[model samples]
Each structure stands twice: as C-alpha cells, then as structure tokens.
Target: MRAEVGIKDAKVMGIGPAGEHMVHAAMLCNDYNHSASHSGGAIFGSKKLKAIVVHGTKRPPLHDKAALIEAGLRWRKTLQQYSVSDRYGVGHARHLEALPNNNMQSSLIADHNRGFDHNRVTQRPCFQCARLCPWDVEIGEGEFKGKIGHFNAGAEWLDTFWNLGVKGNATLYLAERINDLGIECGHFAFGAGVLFEAYEKGLVKAEDCDGLRLEWGNVEAIDKLLEMTARREGKWGNLIADGPLEVAEAIGGDAVKWVVHTKRGVPAMHDWRPHFSNMLREIVASGGMKPQGGGAANPPPDLKYREKWGPLDRDDPKGWPQSNVIAEQYRQFVGLMGGCWFAQMHLKPDGLNSVVDSFNATTGWNFTLDEAMLAGHRSAILQSVFATQRGWIADHDWQQVGQRFIDPVPDGKFKGFTIAKWLPEMVREYYQLSGRHEKTGRPFMNTLVQLGLEEFKEWAQLD
Candidate 1:
C-alpha cells in the first residue's frame, strides 16, 4: 500500500514486537537486518535524520491505570507530564521534579508510563493453594519452623510421589511445590520445576546437573538455581538463567526450540500462539510480554467501558480480540513515550486518552486522536533510528512468521488453533490501516519525514 499510495521513500521504524517484526520483514523484503543498539539512533543520510527506540521503564504510579485516569490524563499528555516517573517509577519523579536541567529524566518518563510496585504483596492476589500437601522440605527450623516455610510437604517419603501419580496432574502438583518453595513465577520461571520433575524421575542426575541435585520439587534445588541465576554460575546455570533459547543453544540440544518462546528468547508463558484471532498480536506488539498479562492469561470477570472510544473497542472486551486491540494501542503509547509497558498496564485502558486533560492542565495543549497518531508515527520513527544504529537491521533479516508461531498452538488448552494461517491477513490489514507498504511492512518515506526523519527519507529513496 505504501508503494501504491506513491510513498516512494522514508526511513521506517519499528519498536518492541512491532520493531522485531519490522526487522524481520525488512530482511525478508530487502534481505538484510541491521538495527541500532538499544542506545543510539540510526542516521540514514547526510542530513543526519535519526530513529530511536527506547522502551518505557518498569515502575509504578504511572503503571496504574486508575491513578492515571484519576489524575486526568490523555495518553500523550500523561507521557509528557510524567515521562520519567511514568517510565521508571514514582521514585524517578523526584529526579524529574528536582530542578531546571533535570528534564532529561522527565523526557524519558514522558516517553513511557510509570512502572508498578511488584514487590507490594497486597497489590497481588494470594498465590497460596487451598489444599495442603506435604513434602520433605527443609526449613530453617529454629526461626521459621512450621511458619509456612518453603516446601512443608513432610517426609511421608513416597507418599508425595504416590499422590502425584494418582493425581496425575504432575504439572499442577509441581507448580504448587515450586510456589511453596517461594520461587518467583514469571514467564516460564518454572523451568526449574520441569527440571526438578525430571531429576526425581531419575531421568537426570547430579552428573547431568553439573554436580547439583535436580531433586524432585526440592526447594533447595530451586534455591540453588536461583543463586546460580543471580551469579550466572556455571555453564548450565548461566545458560538457563538467560532463558531456554540460550540454554538450548549452549547445550546443543533441541530443548530451547521446544521450550516454547517467541522468535526472540522470551518464553511464551501466556501460551498465545494457539489462541485464534489477532489477540496474540498484542504479545507480538509487545517485545515478548503479552500485554494482556505476561505470566498467565485470565479472563476479565468484569470490564468497565469508557463512554467514548479512545483506542480499543470498549464494547467487546474478551480475551484475544480485546487484548489485541489494547495491545496495539499500548504499543503506540509506549513507543511514543519511549517508556516501558510494565507501568502502562497499571494504568486503566482509559487512563491514557485522559492525557488530554493532563495536557491542558500542564502544557496547555488540547490533544486529539490525530495528534496522538502523529506522535505515534514520530515515536515509531525514533525507534527505527535506534534499531538502525544498533546494527539490528539486515536486509531481509526480519522475524519470519514461524509456521509454528503462526500455526498450531503447541503446548496448551488451545493446542490445535493456528495463528500463522490467520495472522498474515491481520498484519496486512494493520499495514493498510497505518498507510504502510503491505509487501515491505514498513511505513512510507513521506510518513517518516512527516514524523521528522528527513535523513531517513534520503537513504530510503536510494536509487
């Protein structure tokens, strides 16, 4: 469509999943992949036009949607006012507010939403399982005896194993055991759990484990892995700590490919590939974290809608579809703010659009959808500059829509659903709507220059 629309030259940019896709698609189209590093922006021409991509921070207050709305902000306006605080956290707010020359932090905060306080236990749901089971878990007996210590499953010896077989839900029981051990469960952080299960079954041993016991749901094993992870200890620990992808690569096994992650190293924890619809695009749009809820996905019991349309279609709020729309808008928001999404999720869906109010209050600008989209365009261009400078670009080196990625949901309830078969259409549709080249999957040169990429325009118009 970009070619059809007479958009001949432009420096294109993609960030997060969008950026990842751009890199892949550009490689496919042009047969190269060269993006800038995470820091510097790329310069395309003698004019020195730049494109930079800085993800929002992972922090609080700005992360909470309710607070953003309550504070009365639109997406762009909130980004402008709380740029640093939004991206980093409320803690960074002080740096932004300190004095005259400190606006750099403020600018960063504006590029992203504030992060959330994940350490605050009250903010999270109780993770404890209801039924009690026992394991011969070692506790600090003296100070923490029976105080709900890690792995309280007592030494009934084989009883736990017996129940596991009878219960037949090795996954469930294993999860419970790991949780009991106080392990942090993030995207596939339970890699240790799977390993522990294998170890108990004698499929793996201390020798196989690099001298550490891969005990069955053993808390000590978890502790060891955690410690190893912190220090990047040993070859095995170092590989696993980075993620299953690197682990698989180092181990020279198919383990990483089968571990279930996106093209990048991120684990597919939300189990997205199978869900039918453009929903998974949200995760694709996010670097890897499924914006709908990274760890595991759950249905929204109750969804409250804003009176008017902001970004997402508020009328239909389900899992996949609603999530896709929200994720796309979220991509736009975070990219423009150069902030992280960890904090963006904290803000309610409407919290961003309310930035209009915040803008009026702070900068005296009445922002509109057109203005917001333009900001999005500029943000995307900046991100492109960043990728180009980082040498993350190569002709046709973009992430391919893996048949497995776009096809069959490999590992969960929605196993048979195919994402690849349907997502291409969605991608094309997205491109069309955005006024981009359908074949190249890159925005036009005019669009780039419009978004402030003159140098990009010159290089893009090569020949």
Candidate 2:
C-alpha cells in the first residue's frame, strides 16, 4: 500500500477476505494494526468498497498552537500519574485482572498460557499521544512465523478472542487470523464458544461443524469455524456468521442461554455483572461497553463544575443509574472529538475542562466543559431516540442483558454476585435520571427539549 501510492504519504484503511464476503460482524483495519472497528467492514464490502486511502499534505490550522501544546502537556502529566502508562513499552499484561474468561462464564484466566512470553514487544505509539498503549510484535517462528502485531489491549484481545476462553500466547494466532480474514473478533469469540457449548449439549451436531469435535481451547476447530464464518462456507459457517445472539435464536432453546450480549452487540469487552453502571450505559446507549472511570474519591466527570455523584461503591448496584446517565454524557462528548476517545477518557481533568480548553485552542472557538458535556449528552440522546424509532425504546429491548451476562459468576472474586436482583431497580433509576417513562423507555418530550432535540418529539413519543 505504501509503495503503490507513489510520493504521496498514503494511510490505507481497508478490509480483507471477511469484508469481501460480507461477514455479518466484519471490522475494518487502518494502516495494518490500528483497528477502525464498529462492525463496519461488511457495510464497506456491501457497497463494493474495499479500502479508503487518505493522502493528505495540509497542516491543520490551530488557533493557539502554544496553548494547545501546553494543554496537551498538562493532560499528559496527569496521565503519567497513572501507573499503566509507565509500562508503555512492556506490552499488554499477559494476564490482567477482571478480563472475563471463557465468554464471561468464568473469571479465571485460562490455564493455556504459552507462546509469545519470549517474543520481544516494543512501544508503537500512535502519532502525538500520551499513555502509549499500542505494542508491535514480530513473530520469529512457529505457525505465525511472519505475523507482525501485538495481542495486548482491550479491543485487540478482549473484543477479538481473549474472552472466548483463550488465555495463553496462542491468542497471537487468533489475533493474526481475525485481522487476516477481516471478520469481527467478538462475533467469532462469542459465537464460536456458544456453538461449542451447543454441541456439548447436543444442540449442534458434528455434521453441522464439518465433523470436527467442538471442544474448549480447540484452536484448530475454532480456526476452521472462523474460516467458515468469514467465507460463509457450509451450513454451520453460514449459521454462526450472524454472531452469537442470532445463532442462538437460530438454534433455539438452551443455546441462547450461553450467549452473553447487550442489544445483540455483545459488549465493548468486560464482565459487567459486578459493574451495574457499565451495563446501564449500554442499555441507554448502544455500546456503553467501557468500564467506569476515576477513583471513588474523585468520581467521574470530576471537572471543577460538576459535583461527585455515582456508584461510590464499586460492588454496590445503587446509584449506578445516575452514574450511567453522566457516563453517557461524557462518553458521547468524547465521541464528538473524533476517534481516540480511549486516549482522552482517563484524562478528563476530572475530564473535559483541560481537554475542552485544548479543543477550543485547536479550533479557535470558545467551548466550555459544560458545552462539551452537553454535546456528549446530545449524542447519547440521539442514539437513544434513533433506537426508539427502531422499536428499541422498551427497557427489555435495551436490557437484553443475556442470561450469561446477568447469571452469577460460577467462580472468581465476584462469586455469587449477580446483577439480576438489582437490574430492575437499576434500570428504573436510569430511566428517572435520563427523564424517561418507566414502562416505555421513550425519553420525555421535555427531555428532548432539554437536549435541544424537540424536533424528535413525535419519534420519542410512544403510544
């Protein structure tokens, strides 16, 4: 891609065989390792679009370059206080706590830890960013002899194949293959496992799976399933290609019980059973799969202007609804800044005050922290309103928190803790905080008016 662009500096963002075949959960990759995800690859392939190469040679106009740099430094300084940033070059921890193992069925990190412990990893920071988290790995031998990438991050690992019961360096092969094929890793991770469980319970047959015995940590069988899904080859491949929830529905009965998801979108990758606020965020907004922010001492949105109000106790389900409302506000606000929200999330200065300062400096505009938050709030409401139009306005529709997600953790630190009991009240409080009717999940007209979205009144109004 680099050589074909001639003298122009081209950044190629394209799909692979998965997107070309229009696999249901296909994702796009930018410049090789940088993931440009959100299940958009199939959309690109459907339109016969392959890759988007951006060749630019213009400098962005900045209102106050000096101030922007200063603000960035301040944000970085705060980010430096975070211990994880110090391990930037060390790559993702082989085993991080609370990563949700075996499709959220257990919390134990799989015992299959092998491969890549000896592979050298180096910091491959994105352009102009603090808290460098991206790592580059080049395989020297084995099945992944020529692979070049790292398997150490949430989106890369969790959303890819980590949560599906893989906990070893064998994750490298799955990571490389998923990107190579361009299918959604989460889709394969969740769908493959549930189907395996289905086979175990006799829900799926050997004939359906190309005669391969489905078993846990069967990398070869999993790999074949991935290939089949990407190519939509054979009956089982086409069946599971729609992802876990759809596959469960297709298989019917006990199959759906094993699938973990919210709104049929799986998760941003986290076991949210113990974290009610995180789950609430997804109920209101589509992929509120990210965990909460800041210390309990600071609370979220700790900008000088807002007061602390949230699920102060991480384990307790109380106050999560309120936290999610604010979380949605902050999350949507981050989205407005364009991708890279992951970088800005922890630096909220409390959040937004300094970042808003930097944004204003770059655009030469007068934007405030409140305005930034308001914009974020507006984005969440827009998604909520759109969801309502699609008959997703009901609390149950949003609360599709599958049995696997709400079911008690069979083992781990959160043993016996389940969101099942608290979910109803938590969802009710979320409605109150978001200013929506309890029965129908529609946001009130006044709520729309508050967000300056009175135009969506009819749509938000439910019969």
Specify the highest-lDDT model's number: 2
Tens-place lDDT per residue, model 2, 1-463, is 6677674568888888778888777778876267755558888889999888887789878889999888777666555322333322212223223456666667654443445554556666667666565666665456666567653345445434556555454566677777778876656777776777787789888776677777766777777877888888877688666767887887788878888766777655555555555555544444432222212323455463465553367667766666566656666666677635655654355345667777877888887777876787777667766666777745763467578877876776668877677757777777766767765767788788888998888866554
Overall lDDT per candidate, in order of appearance: 0.34, 0.65
Off by over 4 Å in 2: 1-8, 80-96, 110-115, 139-146, 150-152, 155-164, 285-298, 345-351
Span of ten consecutive residues with least summed lDDT in model 2? 87-96
Q: Which stretches of candidate 1 lie over 4 Å from their true place?
A: 1-206, 267-269, 274-279, 282-331, 334-352, 388-407, 410-415, 423-441, 458-463
Candidate 1: TM-score? 0.48
RMSD in Å for model 1: 17.8
Clash count (model 1, backbone only): 79
> What TM-score against the true fold does each predicted structure earn?
0.48, 0.88
